[model samples]
Target: MKILVCVKRVIDYNVKVRVKADQSDVDLTNVKMALNPFCEIAVEEAVRLKEQGKADEVVVVSIGPKAVQEQLRTALALGADRAIQIETEAAPEALNTAKLLAKVVEQEQPGLVLMGKQSIDSDNNQTGQMLAALIGAPQATFAYSLELDAEQVVVTREVDGGLKTLALKLPAVVTTDLRLNEPRYVKLPDIMKAKKKPLAVETPDGLGVALKQHQTVLKVEAPGQRQAGIRVDSVDALLDKLKNEAKVI
Candidate 1:
């Protein structure tokens, strides 16, 4: 089986995100970029399947400017057999991205598709489902545990109540959750090896995907500073505060 994994480049989780001075979008000037953590987990899972002899190859793909190649290489270093970059001036919104991926899916025709539940930067959590919808493929989202057989994949996913399990046949899409598996650290030698891995670049136009803008960002703002709590003398005082000052009642 050939697994195709979608990855993204985003600001490192350790770095503090800043809203642009003009409130247009997140400020990404000179920030350290890394693979999306959830996407990393997806890559790890795909690589693990290949390592276990269940999968014959793992191909990683990303969409964005040339800079996204950095994250593609990182995925290669982590064990993806090859990488494909769908070059765009900027990352498209979720649906457009799904369209591009759907085209790639048609071209590659992999047995399974994997990606993060959401990109940390956008937190949209919509791509996987959209891709599945576009391609008319069975989908399992927020999967933390997965088992594969000759024709179907069993996925255990987290739900608000607890967990839900589903069986999806081959040629399906699965979005991974954090608990799926811990990603392995990349060594220097692997990083060096990744440089030589085949990295192909294609444009959205080349894929016959005409990008469309479906939404516009009105503004981007940092979250408000949290207010400090004050001590209450008793339950009565808390109740009074809730009823009046805090206005809960």
Candidate 2:
């Protein structure tokens, strides 16, 4: 099986975010960038499949600004066989990205495509689903575990309260969850070997894909802060507050 894993480059989750002066987006001027944490999990899962000899090859693909090639390299270092970057200068949004990925998916014709359920920077969680829809492939989102048989793929997904399983035909799409797999670090030798891995770059126009506006970002601001609450000295006091002071009972 040939696996295509989509990755993204985003501001590191550990770094504090600063909204741009215009409040349209976060400032990336000096912010540290890293692989999307969830996407990394997807990459790790694909690598494991290859190591098990269940997969023939792993192709890591990213659709975003040219800087995203760094993210693709990170996946290659993690054990992907090759990387493809659909270069774009447009701001990161779900529809445009899905469109570009759809074009590449047409060209690559991988048996399976896997990506993260969502990105840390933009938690929209729309790209993978949209891409699957465009390609007319069966999709399993938030998959925590996956098992493939001769003609079908089985996925255990994380639902609100518990897990649910679904079986889909081959050539499907799967979005991974946080506990899907543990990511491994690239050793020094693999990091050096990644330098020579094939990295293909293409533009939106080069892929014959066009953009259409589906939505706009009005502003991005810090989420509302929580107000401090009074502390009770004893269990009885806490019960009293909830029953009478707070008027719940």
Candidate 3:
């Protein structure tokens, strides 16, 4: 069986985000970029399934500009057999991305589709469900653990309070959460080997997916700066300030 893993390129989690001066969006002129952490976990899980002899191949896919090929290479280094890039000038929102992926799913017909529960940049947490809905597949979101059987897969998911388990038939969608297996480091040798792996590029138009904007961003701004704290000389002083100045007594 073939497993398809979806990954995304985003600003490295370590980098401090800076808002643009015009309030259009975050400034990303020359910031460090890396694969989404949760997507890395999804790639690791797909590779692990292949390594365990449960899958015949693990294919990694990403949708973005040419830079996304870098993240796809990293996924290949981590153990994906091949990579596909859905080339686009700008990244699509969750719904259009799902439409593109649904087209790919129709062509590939993989036994399973795995992706991050949400991208760090957007945090929409809707792509997986949208893809599943588009393709008429069962879905398990926020999955931390999975058990594969001949006919179905049981997934343990992180919910609001505790955990929830679900069994999904083959050709289903699974969105991974943080508590899933940790991603392995990519050694220099593996990175070198990944360079030799096959990477294919396609486009939304090529996939016959009509990209349309359903929403518009009015503005983007950073949060207000927090006020500095001060220490009072005594409880009386503190109480007086709270009552008179802050007026929260």
Candidate-wise lDDT, in order: 0.95, 0.89, 0.94
Q: Which candidate order results from sorting by lDDT in descending order?
A: 1, 3, 2
Q: RMSD of each candidate?
A: 2.4, 1.7, 2.4
Predicted candidate 2 versus true structure: per-residue lDDT over 1-249, tens digit per residue: 889999999999899888888887888898899999999999999999889888888999987778898888899999999999887675457888888888888998888899999999878899889999999999999999998655677999999999999999978889999989889978989888998999998888898977888777788887788999998899999999999888897
TM-score for all predictions?
Answer: 0.92, 0.93, 0.93
User: Once model 3 is optimally superposed onto the true structure by TM-score, how far is the C-alpha of residue 126 displaced, in angstroms?
Assistant: 0.5
lDDT of 1 by residue, 17-129 (tens): 98988999898999999999999999999999999999999999999999999999999999999999999999899999999999999999999999999999999999999
Identify the superior model by lDDT, candidate 2 or candidate 3.
3
- lDDT, candidate 3, residue 85? 100
Winning candidate number (lDDT): 1
In model 2, the worst 10-residue window by lDDT is: 85-94
In candidate 2, how many Å is residue 82 off? 0.7
The parts of candidate 3 lying over 4 Å away from their true place are 231-249
